[model samples]
Target: MHSPDSLYQQLQKIGTSPALTVYGEDRIELSGKVLANHIAKIANFLVDEVELEPGSRVVLDLPLHWKTFAWALAALVAGGNVVVGREKIADAEPGTVVVTSRPHGIELDSGDTVVALPLGSLALSWAGELDPGVYDGAADVMSFPDSLLFSGLGDESNASFYANAVPHVPQGRIGLVSPSVIEAISVGYSTLSSGNSLVIVGATSTADSIFATEHAESFTPPVRI
Candidate 1:
C-alpha cells in the first residue's frame, strides 16, 4: 500500500472506490475514477487556461460541495496553494486566482482572475451568461484532458499537515455534518488518504437519517467558532 504524503497522492490512493457521496438539495455520487477525472480536468485547466504556476495562491470562495472538493484537489495537484475561508480570500494579495460560485453581478477586483463555477455536478456551461472577464470553470475545464500529466511533490511534511488538520482512520466511513468548505475538504482528503469514504450532509434531518442508514463509523459536526 502507498503511504499518502500529499493531497494528490491521497487522491491517487483512493484508486477505484466510491470516494464521496454528498447529500443536500442535490444528491451526487463520485467514484474514485470519476473524482480523479474531475480533479485532472480542473488541474489541467488551472495550469493551461488560468496559467497557474507552482506555489501560486488559488482562493476558493465556494460552498461545501463536491465542486469545492474538486477545486481544492485540482489546486493541490497543480502545485498551487489552496486558500480556504472567505476572510482569507478577502485578504488575499493581488494576482490571486479566485474561484467562486456567486452570481455574475458581484463586484470582484484585486487584480484577481475570477473563475465562476456553475456548481452543477455535470454541467457543461454556466446556467446564465457569465459577465465579461469571468471565466466559466465548467466550460473551461471541458477543454482539458481527463488525466493530469504532472505529479505533485509529495513528502512527509504534507502528510503531517493533513494528519494534524483531520486525522484519518483507515477504511473508516466518515460522516460530516454542516462543515465549512475548508473543514469538509480537509476531512474528505484525510478520509481518502486512509482508504476511507465520506458522507457529507448539509441538513440536520438528512444527516441524522444518513448516519443511521450508512452506519458511519465517525461523525464530525461543524466547528463552533
Candidate 2:
C-alpha cells in the first residue's frame, strides 16, 4: 500500500511475486527478491569496482530489455545520474560509466568504464573475449552480496532518471511496450509504484502469445495524436 515516490522507494516496494518477465528467445522471469539481488549486485559493482562517484553520469546504451531497466535502477540507487539516449552515450565524459550490450560500438576514453552484458538469458559471462578494460557485467556481479549499504548519498537532480507523465499502472502483471527507453522506464516506474509486475515482449516474440501466457494485460503507450 506504500506509494513510492523515488526510484529507491519503488525498488523497495517489490514483493515476493515475479516482478519482471521478459518474453524473448528465452523467457526470463525474475522474482522481486531476485531482481533486488540483481540490482544490489550491479550497484555494488558500480560503487565498489567502478568506483562511481555521487552524481556521476551512468549511461545506459542498451535497448529496452529487463537487464537494461535493472542497470538503470542500480545506477540511480548507487547515487549516479542515469543517462539514456544515443546522444548522451556519444557525449559521455571520460569518467562516465557506460553499460551496453554492444560494447565494441562504444569508444572508451581515459577514466571511462564500460560493462558488457551478454545477450543470452542464461549466460554467466561474456561468451567471447572482451576488450582489455571493459568489465563483463554478467560475470562480475555474481560475487557481490544481495544487500547494499552506502553513505553520503547525493540527491537525484537529473529529471531524465524519473518518470514523467506516465499513466497509473494497475496492480497486476501487465505487458508494456514503449517507443523509447526513457518512456519504457517511465511506464516501469509507474508499474512498480503501483505494485504491478511488468512483462516486456521482445522483438522476436508475438505479443498476443506472450501476454496470454503471462496473463498480463496489454498496456500500450497512449497515442499523442
For candidate 1, write residues 34-145 as lDDT tens digits.
8878888888888778777666678888888899988887777676677776666667665678898884555556566889898777688888878787899888888788
Please give the range of 10 consecutive residues that has the lowest summed lDDT in model 1.
153-162
lDDT of 1: 0.71
Candidate 1 backbone collisions, by pair: none
Residue 111 lDDT (model 1): 60
Q: Could you give candidate 2's per-residue lDDT for residues 1-225 as a string of tens digits?
A: 222124444455675688888765567888777777777888888889999987789988888777888887777668787888656877887689988888886786889998998866678999898988899999998798877756334354253435554555566778864446776666766676566778887554478777888898987767321
Per-model lDDT: 0.71, 0.73
Error of 1 at 3 (Å): 9.0
Predicted structure with the largest lDDT when compared to the true one: 2
TM-score of every prediction relative to native: 0.83, 0.83
